[model samples]
Target: MPDTKPALSKVSVMQDLLKVVAPYRWRIAAAVVLLISAKISTVLVPLLLKRIIDALSQPQTLKALPIYLLAGYALLRFSSTLFNELRDLVFSRVTQRTVANYAQMTFEHLHLLGARFHAKRRMGGLLPDIDRGTAGIAFLLGVGLFTLVPTLIEIALVLGIITSRYQAWYAGFIMLTFLVYTGFTVVFTARRTIHQRRVNRLDSSAKSRLADSLINYDTVKYFTNETVEAQRFEEIMRHWTEAAVANQKALFTLHVGQSAIIACGVAAVMLQAGSDVMAGRMTVGDLVLINAYVLQVCLPLNALGFVYREARDAWVNAERLFDILHERPEMEESRGMPALSPGRGEVVFEHVSFSYEPSRPILRDVSFRIAPGATLAVVGGSGSGKSTLARLLLKLYAPAEGRILVDGQDIARVSATSVRSMIGVVPQDTVLFNDTIGYNIAYGRVGASQEETVGAAKAAHIHELITTLPGQYDTEVGERGVTLSGGERQRIAVARAVLKNPPILIFDEATSALDSASEHAIQQELNRLSHNRTVLMIAHRLSTVVDADEIIVLEQGRVIERGSHEELLGKHGAYARLWQLQQREDMDQRAAASRA
Candidate 1:
């Protein structure tokens, strides 16, 4: 197991965040400068007001009130607003670009992770985490940086001015008040985090259940379990509703506690200022200035309290995403590994062994070789490890006991991307992206020209059907090609593999979903596509592999018989038994269909 670190500190999180902003350093520097300038302008406005008030209180000087001071006060206020807006304008690009970059990096990293990780994690749950993480990043960049940092600077400036210019009592009261307010916010916000995290988890669970149920809607309808699904979904929502309420209550405690602290601080300052003014020791301008400073300081503290609370949750969400990025892939790219070198398309598996879980071995000491420009078919019953061989050859899972080689290179030593580039597969289950028919086929070979796409479709016997659709080649294949028939979808998958035109091809039960007529048509196309290429065909139906150059019957991860179509049948072993069984099933199916 990988080592886990203790909870991360806010400062540590912030330091890590700097790496993301490093590319946009100059813009960030500009934003920081603007922030300081804006705060300086804001601080000076109250001081200008002090001067204006003192001038007005003196009857003799009122007639000669300085217009420049009055005008400068207005300009400073406007400049504060202008500088803040300009700061946001500069920083928006940094925040947006950083979010996009991190999102893209996460996407690529997920693809790099092992298939095991995807199998264990639900797609619905994973997607919401990603969305929340990006949103957290945005909050930190825009609100936390802009609001929290500037609020601190403004507070420090206010405290410094009060201590130097006013009586010690004024500064002391403000400091004590600030410390009390901060202490309360820190303690109560910490308490709120528990509720916030619960809310996040509940929300994620609800979304996960909803998405899973929707994805399996057909199964639910077939089983008539709509009410059961609805009740299960309601259970998740009930938990979420309770969590939200608890979160709100915690928020109420934090805000009310903070308000009480601010009230005490403001009342103390006002009482002291009133006494100083009545005793003729201070001017009315001093009283007004103190009042203005109190409001300025405390209001931001309120906003800062809320921001700090929200930022903690944001940090938690972002950390979850970062954790996923940190996961190690099952297969690592060897440093300086060269790409696969092209040859005669020979594949060799030497004493390969593998298991999805250690307790249940899927393939044991499996050895096989396909000569260059040859077709080798593997036949077996369900769970006999036939498909596992294809997965091992594709390098989806590394062997536990042996190695696989492609074109004389140990596949484990070469880059997987390079290995897959030379091979094409038509999976047992055909799933197309919700896109145009042409786009799905062209996905096999990115940058394939329009002519090449249409040619491959025509070769697969799908071009004529596509042309008849209202949108022709541009017709949208609804999600997972639900709009297309089983045969139509398989034909599209065939077209994709054909367009790839790789040196090796794998058809894993490629025609299992088709009718007899469609199967005959598709089988002919598959044969033509397999010509002059190394092919590994895996099928449960014995008839599919009867014409292969060589055949191997695997039973419980062991090859029990090997020969040509007639040679295996002559033995009357596992291969012959399977053929006889399938032949009888075919006859029965034909009789049943005719009767119906």
Candidate 2:
């Protein structure tokens, strides 16, 4: 959802803007010198009018008048053009560099932030904020600070010249009145523009979230939740529209106030100058200079409002983007991490208790151990902590209490990166990145050979499908592998695991959502894959894992039984009852097929 409130203001934003430009400060300093020099030439041109006016009123001296003024004016305009060009080139380079660096830093930090942070955040809140924030920084520093700052400095310079060369009281009067006019205009305009920016931020975020929902339209359709999701999206858009309309209304009021004040100030200044000339106190040149100078000074003052609008917007984004940059990652072991190497692949869960939230345990003092090369089949109902145990062993979530040792070293005492590198997991819903088949298969290692990738794909029975495609291994799988069937996606997951060749393997309901034909093909591949590694299989289809070396049956986060299928059946306990239930389900499926 869109954030309803503005996170920052332009006044607060410009204060820290220097940090974004700090790395390029030297270049900025050089550019500022050029910009200021160029600005002086433009500012001086109006004063030359006073000289031209005096020459005309004086005794006609060959009227060298027009020629001299034209030459001097042309020279000043040329120099202004040269220096301004240099300033533009320098500022463009610096601004682009700064934007690139900030965007890169934000993206890098997002990747390091781990899964939990992503889980809590909305895409609606993140992507647009970051994009806007980075673009704002470029505008604020490049134009607002560099371009607008010099414009204001030139105005003050003109005011200084007017007070010294003309009448001090008159110059003071002009400065005071003009300042009041522009100041009020800027303040009123800022309020409206700021509101509009906030509205746009909300609108952009809602649209992004809607796009994400559409990308997963299959899930919405399958669950018959299309109408529900469409209504939710409409609700967010309705609020966005209301905010936008209010902001536009405020902006219209601001423009009216600003235009009237500027027009009045110009008219008042010219009238005062004309009256002085008529009274014989001021020369004809004085009127011409005053008219031109007023327009020049008013340009930058008016632009102040535009700069303020962009500055406020840039800061709003900066706050959100920085929030991601400053976030701490999930608790990672900082010290005493032992080396991870191939060992027994033994998994020992000793009094392991864990909870995502305190006093709300997922696994309660659960304890179990499996030797190297042993197949451990975990069986339980939903939320019984079976998958939780597997995740703990893989170090996806650290156990709240007790320890899990692999190769006689606690998994917690080893670097998560290395520990996870040696383990392969096949999750229930197989997810594939948008990449070529070759790249996805070779993802387990950065420098895998084509031979290895193909070999792994062949073992998983997906090599045939890849070869049939025009590009073979080079074909791009569409987003989240949507171009592939459920069975095809699962086989790709198997291929990835085969490529990884980890000492430990986990299949968490890997084949539970497949047709019988796809299930049987994948089961054969899985059996071959578990040959020399420690395997943990969590499945709803009990018959598939009937030949597992050992089974640890859980009930409400507690392991209640452990043995082979035959041994458990002989005991006529939980495993026996489960086996009977699976047989009934198999018979039902067959009966349905026969009736059809």
Candidate 3:
């Protein structure tokens, strides 16, 4: 029942990373060259130091302070730093670009995904996953490449030099130490990874709870359940804290173990060097050189353990992101699919059946037709599949057992974009972006001019109301347009559909939130707008659909009655019952108003 897909393997994650980095291969190569230069300079610095020590130790060679050698030592040290800085500078663009590329790809893909996928996703947890995923890419590129690879190269160079110039025992001791240190790190870090994963999961859960609580702040306040929400959020955070502590304990163990191994290795190597010097088999300069090489190798080995651990964490984060990329979209848009041809808006559904799940069917054997420039109204109680019909027409979901046609063409044969472009919908629950009113209106048709947006607002009968506000069209609609009243949000939805001016229109309880006067005015505008366009009206108010060219009464996803409003009333079926009940309710409301 969980929405998340399985995490990708480390190999797959790396393969995806390489594909993104392939475009910057030349830059990466340049960075690698700089890396080698830096390491070479680094290795030569200690050699120069050994020479300085040998020269200083011998009475005959102490003259002139070995100025050239001292100068070379300083220059090599500076050159090492200089090359490392230059490598980072050259490769910085590649890391940043790769992050941006993946972020944009994920963002665009989220929009292309179906409503079903989005309905199941929690925005709170989803955002953190994306943030961590992109950050992981940056770490793997910057630290993993520079630290891991350079450390290995330096190790190889140090081992090679020590084996050629010193006793075989020195090189052998360091190699054995490296193997043990690496083996220890791998085993401990693997165990720590399990803890790290748990920490990440709990962290996401806590954030999800926080966001869910804040988003429903009004609901909590209404029910006086602030304490309940706090308790729930605290519970999740408590688990996160526990997991984080466990992860830290594992990290401490790994670090302490690594330090112990390196300390023993260094002590052993230094003891051997001292014995060799005392026995006359090596000079004081050889002792210093051997000491310098051992420390050099051990320091990076320590850092190598840390880098390897972080890389594993990075791999986990990247795997979660790549899993999202691997998810198959509910509907695939094939390449070179034909666009729906422009024509009179004639819509038809043939034996269409659909279900969100096999056990719960939403629509069944539904068939209907809307003639060009005519309106067909569908009436039903709650859960009768009236909205599903509109969803099917908009190509939001594919029909399970039948096909829908627009302008005599099967919609499945055309690109979804084309099908959607030809129709406009006003949903019952209108949720607007947290933006200026003009922006929300213009979203109906991207890049619409100010004049066009204002005109559409006027058509929806909300222009005067907007002008009364301080900011007018520029007024901010807060999150989900919560700043506005329900009727106001409905008007904006109607304005958006009006702005689109598509060949086909679907009004799913479009005027349900408006007052009677506003509803009557908007209803007239909607009728005018529906002229010369196919319209599917899904309504609960019997009064609004009385003038529909034809009416279909749906009960449990089946059309039980079909005819003109008057004809249905004459039949005294479900439609008649609904009309009579609404009439009585209207009369009672009027009587109550008079009494008041």
Candidate 4:
């Protein structure tokens, strides 16, 4: 589980971030050198001012000094600006690449994970972690590399210069006072402030969830739980507001304390420099020099605060980023799986026992076989393991015990991709992405052209529908095929399967959602498409599969009866009961339509 605690300080977080920047070590080295040059220029202005003052004290060296110093100062500022821009350019590339790599790596890991992992994971929880990880990259670049480390360098150089030229007293006064101010503020305020930070993350997550909810408002309205959902969202927002305010209060206190310390430090440094000037040891320009040094030191010091804030957040993100980069996919490909011979479409389920849970078996001693170029329909009520059998066959879920054979070869031994390509699936859910109708149809076979796509659509009886749309085959399906009716989507799925032209076809309720007229049309397509192909199918409606070569009735994960429709009714088992029920329902529907 990811820690929900708001990263309170950057001091600890930044140490490890420096390691990730190791790959582009040379670029970072160049960036560091430029930063050092910039800092040296920044620190030198005070020394130049001191020299200008010393020269002015002697009438002999006065004339040339002012012009020389002014020119040098202008040159230093220009160089600093150039170096600063270069440093930023280098840093931006490094950050961009790191963030892109991390996001892609994480996305890949999430997708590779099994269905079980996603089933328990909340979309909100996973999404925020990704956002937090990406957002942390900005913080790492700004604080970890740029602000924090540069501040340390600035403080070390400033104190060294001040003590060597003047007295240890000057460096001591500045460092001691700065430390005291920082220490007191952090001790009193950090606990409350960090709590607020966590609150803000959750609040941000809540807003993302709310936006998703609004986009899915149609589903919310259809379920008629608008008031219940509104209240739930409102409650989340309220929690977020409380946490946001707490964070604000903590930051406000820290800033107010920091500002007061800055004022005191400025006054004290000036007072000391003023006394030196009055004593004839320092001149007006020397005072200017000391003031410049004080200001330079303070800039890095304030930057340290910003560094601490951002670094805290970045470290949390690093943990998430690393988690993804290090993940290994389960079920590694076997070393010696030979290429499968052209499939004869003969499948055998040999006493295959499988379950999602250790305690409960979804399929127990289930055994069946379909001969080459044969059609077999499996009929079962909900939770009777019909779909689990299909999944086991597809190698989506491997059987716990026993084995399945394809074309006289163990399925586990053959290449999973090769096995899958030999069998095309028109699944229960006809999923279509937001793409053109032509592309969606052509997805079954790569590089399929307009002619091929339309041919498949014509076979599925959807070619007329495609031509009626504004863009014809170019029309977008919208999200999950929402632009078309369920029957239309089903036809498109069937069309894709037809295009695949696999040796074996598995239709899991392919025509279940279609109206009678649409189903009748697609039924002809299925018959034509299934010719010379081994068809293993599952269907809810009896009328569609009544003509199958064999109909197997499954109950409680066991095949209780197997025969043709007439033969099953004569046997008067589970298949007979299902057949009678469906017949009664069809008769009632026809009778009601006639009366109306």
| TM-score, model 2 to reference | 0.89
Residues 124-221, model 1: lDDT tens digits: 78888999999999998889989998999999999999888989998888889888988888899889898888888888888889989998989999
RMSD each, Å: 1.9, 3.8, 2.4, 3.9
TM, every model = 0.97, 0.89, 0.97, 0.88
lDDT of 4 by residue, 20-50 (tens): 5679888888888988888787777678767
Where in model 1 is the C-alpha error above 4 Å?
Answer: 1-4, 7-16
Candidate 2 stretches with Cα past 4 Å from truth are 1-21, 56-59, 63-68, 177-194, 197-201, 219-232, 332-342
RMSD (CA, angstroms), candidate 3: 2.4
Name the better of 2 and 4 by lDDT: 2
Off by over 4 Å in 3: 1-8
Inter-residue clash pairs, candidate 3 = none
Candidate 2 lDDT, tens digit per residue, 546-567? 9899988888788888889889
Model 2 steric clash pairs: none
Candidate 3 global lDDT: 0.90
Residue-pair clash count for candidate 2: 0
| 293-318 per-residue lDDT for model 3 (tens digits) | 88888988988998899988987777
Q: Which of the two, 1 or 2, has more lDDT? A: 1
